[model samples]
Target: MDTITHTLFGLTLYGTVDKKEMDKNHKRAYLVTAVGASLIPDIDVISRLWDTAGQYQMWHRGITHSIFVTPLWAALLFLICAVLFKTKDKRLFFLGWLAVVIHDTSDLFNAWGTGYLEPFSNDRITFGTIPIIDLVFWTIMGIAFVLSKKNKKKSPYYFKMAWILMSLHLIIQSIQGFLIYNQYDGKYDQVALSADFVPWTYSVIVKQDDTVTIFQDNLFQEEKERYVLVSDKGADLDYLFSRRPEAKTLYEWSPFVVVVDDGKRLGLYDPRFYREGQSFLYEYIER
Candidate 1:
C-alpha cells in the first residue's frame, strides 16, 4: 500500500478505540502508537543513502517488514508511549502490534511485494491482487469518515465497518488474482501478474522460452494481448553484471526478465512493468 493508505489505516485503528473518557495526553499517545506502527516498517528506506551494493530494490521491502520485527517494534513503541504520556495503558502495545502487522501484511497484495518472511525466507511474496494505490480502499474509508461525521457517537463503529469492508475487498481481489494466475501457470514457462489500477483487472505476463507476452486481463473475460517481448536468449551477462551491479540485482529480483542485447547495450528488464517503448525497471550498460 502507499503512504496515504497506511496513514488511513493508522487513523482507522486509532478511531476504533474508545477515547471518550481519556485525557488529551493519553489520547495523543494512542494516536501516535497507531500511526507510528503503521509506517515504521518503511524506515528501511534509509538504507538507500548507503546502498553501495546497488541492492536498494531488494532492501527497501526487506527484513524490516518481517513478522519477526513487528513485536520488537511494538515493544519499543510501548516503552516510548508509556514514558512520554506517563500512562501504563497496555492497550497501546496491542494497538501498535496490530498496526504493524497490518502494514506488513498489506504490502503482500501489491506487485512490488515485501519480504514478509525476511530472515527466514528472502522470497518476495506478491499476490498482485490489489493496486498499490487502491481507490476502493480510499472510497470505503471515505464513506466511513462521512458517516461518522453524521453520527459522532457511533464513529468507532463506522471505522470498524470500514475495516470489515476493506478485508472483504482484499479477499475478493485475491481470489480473483489466484484464479487468473493458475489459469496461465500451465501454459507458460513462467508467469507474473501486475494488478491494474482498476479493480478486477490485471496485466498478466507469461514467459515461454525467450518470448514474453503481456495481456490486459480480467477473470471474467478473455485476455487482450498488449505487448510481446523477446529476450536475448543465452546472452553472456557476466560483463553486464560487472558494469552495472544493479542489473544483476534486477535479474535476480524479478520472477522473469527480458535480457536485452541489441549489439549496442547489455541490459535486463522485468517484463511486468514494460510500457510504451521502454520499461521503468530496465537496467542497462552501453557498449
Candidate 2:
C-alpha cells in the first residue's frame, strides 16, 4: 500500500479506540503511537541514500517490514511515548504493536510485496490481490470519518465497522485473484497477478518459455489480452547487467520479466507493470 493508505490506517485505528476516559496527555500518546507505528516500517526507504549497487529494490521493503521486527518497532514507539507522555499504560504497547503488525500485513496484498519474513526468507511474498492505492479503502475510511463526526458517541464502533468492511474487501479481492490464477493452471509455466486500480479487475501475466502474455481480467466479464511480450532468450545479459546493475536486481526481484534485446537497447521489465508501450519498473541499458 501507499503512504496515504497507511496513514489512513493509522487514523482509523486511533478512531477505533475509545478515549473519552483518558486524559489529554494519554490521548496524545495514543495518537503518536498509531501514526508512528504505521509509518515506521517504511523507514527502510532511507537505504536508497547509500544504495550504489542497485540493491535499493531489495532493501526498501526489507527487514524493517519483517514480522519479527514488528514488536521491536512497537516497543520503540512505546518507549518514546512513555518518556514523552510519562505514562506507563500497557495498552499503549499493545496498540502500538497492532498498528505495526497491520502495516506489515497490509503490504502483502500488493504486487510490490514486503519482506515480511526477512532474514528467514528473502522471498517477496506478494498476493497481488489489492492495488497499491485502494480507493475502496479510502472511501470506506472517509465515510466512517463523516459518520464518526455526526455520531461522536459511537465513533469507535463506526471505525471498527470500517475495519471489518476493509477486511471483507481484501478477502473478496484475494478470492477473485486466486480463482483467476487457477484458471490458467496448466496453460502457462508461471503466472503473476497485479490488481487494477478499479476493484475486481486484475492484470494477469502468464509466462510460457520465451513468450509472456498479459491479460486484463474481471470476474464478471471476459478476460482481454492486453500485450504479448517476447523475451530474448539467447541474448547475453552479462553486458546489460554490467552497465545497469539495477536490471539484475529487477530480474532477481521479479517473478519473471520480459527481456528486450533490440541490438540498440537491452532492457528487462515485469510484464505485470507494463503500460503504454513501457513499464515504470523497467531497467534498461542502451547498447
Candidate 3:
C-alpha cells in the first residue's frame, strides 16, 4: 500500500485512541508512528539499490516486509519518538508496534508478494489476493479524509467505521482471489490476479506467458518489461534455470535469471523484449 492509506490508517487509529484516552500528544505520536512504520516494508529497495547493485539484489518488499521487523522497527522508532516527545504512555508504544504490523498486513493483499522471513528463509509468500492500488479504495479514503478534515467534530466513530469498511473490502477481495485461484486449470490459465491496498498494487504472476497479466478488480494488465516470472512449484533455483534456457553466459536466480544471448550485441531479454531484427532462435543462452 501507498503512504496515504497508511497515513489515513494511522490517523484513524490515533484519532480513535485519542478520543478514548483524551491524550492529544499520544494521538499525534501514534499517527506519526503509523505513517513511518508503513514505509518500513519498502526499505529493501533502498538496501538493494544502494547496498547491493545487481547480482540477485533484494528489492522493494522482501525480508524487511516480514512480521519480524515490526517490533524491532517500531521499538526503535518509538524510542526515538519518546526521546523527542518526552512522553510516557505505554499505549503509545503499543500503537507504534500495531501500526507497523498493520503496514505489513496492507501488503498481503498484493500479488507482487513479500518475504515475511527473508533473512530466515528466502521463500516468498503471497496469497495472490489484491492489487497494490485500487482506485475505489483510494477514492473512499480520499473522501473520508477530506470529509473528516473539513468537519469540526472530531468523532472517532466515523474514523472507525471507515477503517472497518476498508478492511471489509479487502477481505471480500481476498475471497474472490481464492475462488479465482481454485478455478485455475491448465498452465497460463487464470494466471494474473491483483490485490490492492490503495496506492500500492501487488500483482501475482502465477504463470508467465508472452505477456504477464496482472489481475486487479477483475481486469488484467500485461507486464511488458517489468519482471521475469518463473514457476516455483518445485525444484531449486539452479534446477529451474536449467529447465528455462541453455545459455553459457546465462545467470540464474530464484524465480528469474539473466540470460545473455549472442545477439547483434549483448542485451537483456526474457520473453518480453521487442526490438528490430531480433531472432528468438539465434538467441544465444537462457537461464
Candidate 4:
C-alpha cells in the first residue's frame, strides 16, 4: 500500500479505540502509537542514501517489514509512550502490534511485495490482489469518518465497521485474482498479476521462452493483450552490469525481465510495469 493508505489505516485504528475517558496525555500517546507504527517500517526509505550496492529495491521493504520485527516495533512504541507520557498501559503494546502488522501485511496484497520472512528468506511475497492505491479503501475510510460525525458518541464503532468492510473487499478481490491467476496455470513458464485501478480488473504478465505478453483482464470480459515484448535471452551483460550495477539489482529483484539487446542499446525491464512505452522500474545502460 501507499503512504497515504497506511496513514489512513493508522487513523482508522486510532478511531477504533474509544478515548472519551482518557486524559489529554493518554490521548496523545494513543495517537502517536497508532500513526507511528504504521510508518516505522517505511523508515527503510532512508537506506537508499547509503545504498552503494544498488540494494535499495530489496532493502526498502526488507527486514524492517518482517513479521519478526513487529514485536520490536511495538516494544519501541510502548517505551516511547512510557517515557513521553509516563503511561504504563500495556494495551498500547498490543495496539502497536496491530498497527505494525497491518502495515506489513497490507503491502503483501500489491504487486510491490514485502519481505515478510526476511533473514529466513529473501522472496518478496505478493498476492497482487489489490492495487497499490485502492480507492475502495479510501472510500470505506471516508464513509467511516463521515458517519462518525453523525454519531460522535459511537465513533469507534464506525471505524470498526470500516475495518470489517475493508477486509471483505480484500477477500473478494483476492478470490477473483486467484481464480484469474489459476486459469493460466501450467500454460505459461511464468505468470504475474497486477490488479488494475478498476476493481476486478488485472494486468496479467505471462512469459514463455523469450517472449512476454501482458494482458488487460476483466473477469466478465474477453482479455486484451496490451503489450508483447521479446527478450534477448542470449545477450551477454557483463559490460552493462559493470557500468550500471543497479541493472543487476533490478534483474535480481524482478521475477522476470524482457531483455533488449538490439545492438543500438542493451537493457532490460520488468514487463509488469510497462506503460506509455516504458517501464517505471527499468534500469538500463546505453551502448
Candidate 5:
C-alpha cells in the first residue's frame, strides 16, 4: 500500500476506461489524479508527523482506506472534478471510485498491512503474503507503461497486460498468506526468505538471535541476521513513481539516511530506528 502501487492502479484504471480521450494532456492528468489519490489515503500523515504520531495511529490509513471512506473520497473527488473541469461524466466518476476501491484491494497483500475495516477495529489487516513490491512484477508494469507512452497505438494493450499481471501476482500472494496463517496459527512471523517461505519484496521477517526476537521488514533477504525495511528498500517510492515520471519529485525527500557506501549501492538506515547495535541493519542500493 505504498504510494506508488495505489497511484498505478488509479492511473491505469483511468487510462483503460477512458481510452478515447488518451491524449498527452489527458494521460498527464490521469497521472496527477492517481498520485493525488494515492496520497489522499495518507493525509493522516500530517497530523501524525506534526502534532503527534499517535494521531495518525488513531486515524492514519484507517478511515480513509475503509469501505465507508472510499465512497466519500470518490464523491469528494467527483465534486472537485465537476467544479474544476465542469464535466459530470458519471462513467469517469465511477471509474475514479473504482480506482480507490482497487487501491484498497492491492493494499490487502502489502507487508505493513492496512485497515480496510477501521473504526470498527484498529487492528491492521494483511494476508501476510506479498512483499510490498516485487521486482519482476514492477519491471513488467513499468516496461508496459513506458511502451504505452512511446507508442500510443499499443498503450491500451500494454496497460491492460500490466494491470492483469499485477493483479494475478497479488492474488497468488494473498492465497499464500492465508495458507501460512492457517498453518502457523500466527505463530510464525508469516514472512520467510524464499518461496519455501514467500518470494516478495516486502514481508515481516522474524529475527531471533539467542533470545531477542523482533519483527524486521524483509525486502531484500540477505543473511539470516540481515534484513531491511520495506520503505528502506524503496517500497513506497517504487510504487508511486513506477508509472508517472513526474512524481519522482515527491520521493526526493527520503525518510531514511544514507549510512555507508559499498561502491555499487549506497547503504541506508531509517532515521526512525537508527541507534546503537541496530545500526547494523543499514541496507545498500544504488540510487
Candidate 6:
C-alpha cells in the first residue's frame, strides 16, 4: 500500500477504539502508538542514504517490514510511550503490535511485495491481488469518516464496519485475480499479475522462453493484448551491470524482466509495469 493509505489505516484503527474513558495523556499515547507503528516500517526508505552497493532495491521494504521485526517495533514504541507519557499500560504494547503487524501484512497483497520473513527468507511474497492505491479502501474510509462525524456516539462501530468492508474488497479482488491468473495456467512458462487501480482489472504478464506478453484483463470484458516483448537470450549483461549497477538490482528485484539488447543499447524492464510506450521501472545502459 502507499504511504497515505497506511496513514489512513492508523487513523481508522484509532477511531475504532473507544477512548472515551481514557485520560487525555493516555489518549495521546494511544494516538501516537497507532500513527507511529503505521509509519515505522517505511523507515527502511532511509537506507538509500547509506546504500553503496546499489542494494537499495532490496533494502527498501526489506527487513524493516518483516513480521519478525514488528514486535520489536512495538516494544520500542511501548518504551517511548512509557518514557514520554509516564503511562505504564500493558495494553499499549498490544495496540502497537497490532498496528505494526497490520502494516507488514497488508503490504503482501500488492504487486510490489515485502520481505515479510526477512532474515529467515529473502523471498518477496506478493499476491498481486490489490493495487498499490486501492480506491475502494479510500471510499470505505471516507464514508466511515463522514458517518463518524454524524454519529459521534457510534464512531467506533462505524470504523469497525469500515475495516470489515475493506477486508471484503480485498477478498473479492483476490478471487477475481485468481480466476484471471488460472486462465493462463499451462499456457506460459511463467506468469505475473499487477492489479489495476480499478477493481477486477489486472495486467497479466506471461513469459515463454524469450518472448513476454502483456495482457489487460477484466472479469466482465474480454482480455486485450497490450504489448509483446522479446528478450535477446545472448545479450551479455556484464558490461551493462558494470556501467549501471541499478540495472542489476532492478533485474533481481523484479519477478521477471523483458531484456532488450540491440547493438546500440542494452536494457531490461518488468513487463507487468509496461505502460504508455515504456515502463517506469526500466533500467538500462547504452552500448
TM-score per prediction, in order, is: 0.96, 0.98, 0.67, 0.97, 0.63, 0.96
C-alpha lDDT (0 to 100) for residue 66 of candidate 6: 93
Q: Which regions of candidate 4 are displaced past 4 Å?
A: none
Q: How good is model 6 by TM-score? A: 0.96
Measured with C-alpha atoms, the lDDT of residue 97 in candidate 1 is: 97
- After superposition, the stretches of candidate 1 with alpha carbons farther than 4 Å from their true spots are none
lDDT of each: 0.91, 0.93, 0.55, 0.92, 0.52, 0.91
Q: Which parts of model 3 have CA positions greater than 4 angstroms off?
A: 19-24, 53-59, 185-192, 195-287
| Candidate with the larger lDDT of 2 and 4 | 2
**Cand. 3 Cα-lDDT:** 0.55
Show model 6 residue runs off by greater than 4 Å: none
Residue 29's lDDT in candidate 6: 91
- Per-residue alpha-carbon lDDT of candidate 3 for residues 1-287, written as tens digits (9 for 90 to 100): 66666666676666555355446666566667666665655666555445433422334566677788788887876887788767666666677788778878777665445667767875556565655556666666666667767773755556666778888877877776676555443565435454434333333444443333333333243333334433223324344334434322123222332233333333333221212433132223232
Consecutive 10-residue window with the lowest summed lDDT within model 6: 278-287
The residue pairs found clashing in candidate 2 are none
lDDT of 4 by residue, 15-91 (tens): 99999899999999999999999989999999988989888888989999999999999999999999999999999
Colliding pairs, model 5: 4-239, 4-240, 131-202, 265-285
Instruction: Output the TM-score of candidate 1.
Output: 0.96
* lDDT tens readout by residue for model 1, 106-206: 99998887899989999999888898899999999999889988998999999999999999999998889998888899988989998888899988999
Compose the digit string of candidate 2's lDDT tens values, residues 1-287. 99999999999999999999999899999999999999999999899899899999999888999999988999999999999999899898899999999999999999997899998999999999999999999999999999999999999999999999999999999999999988886888999999999999999999999999999998899999999899999887888899899999999999998889898888889887888898899899877
Error of 2 at 60 (Å): 1.5
Of models 1 and 5, which has the larger lDDT? Answer: 1
Best by lDDT: 2
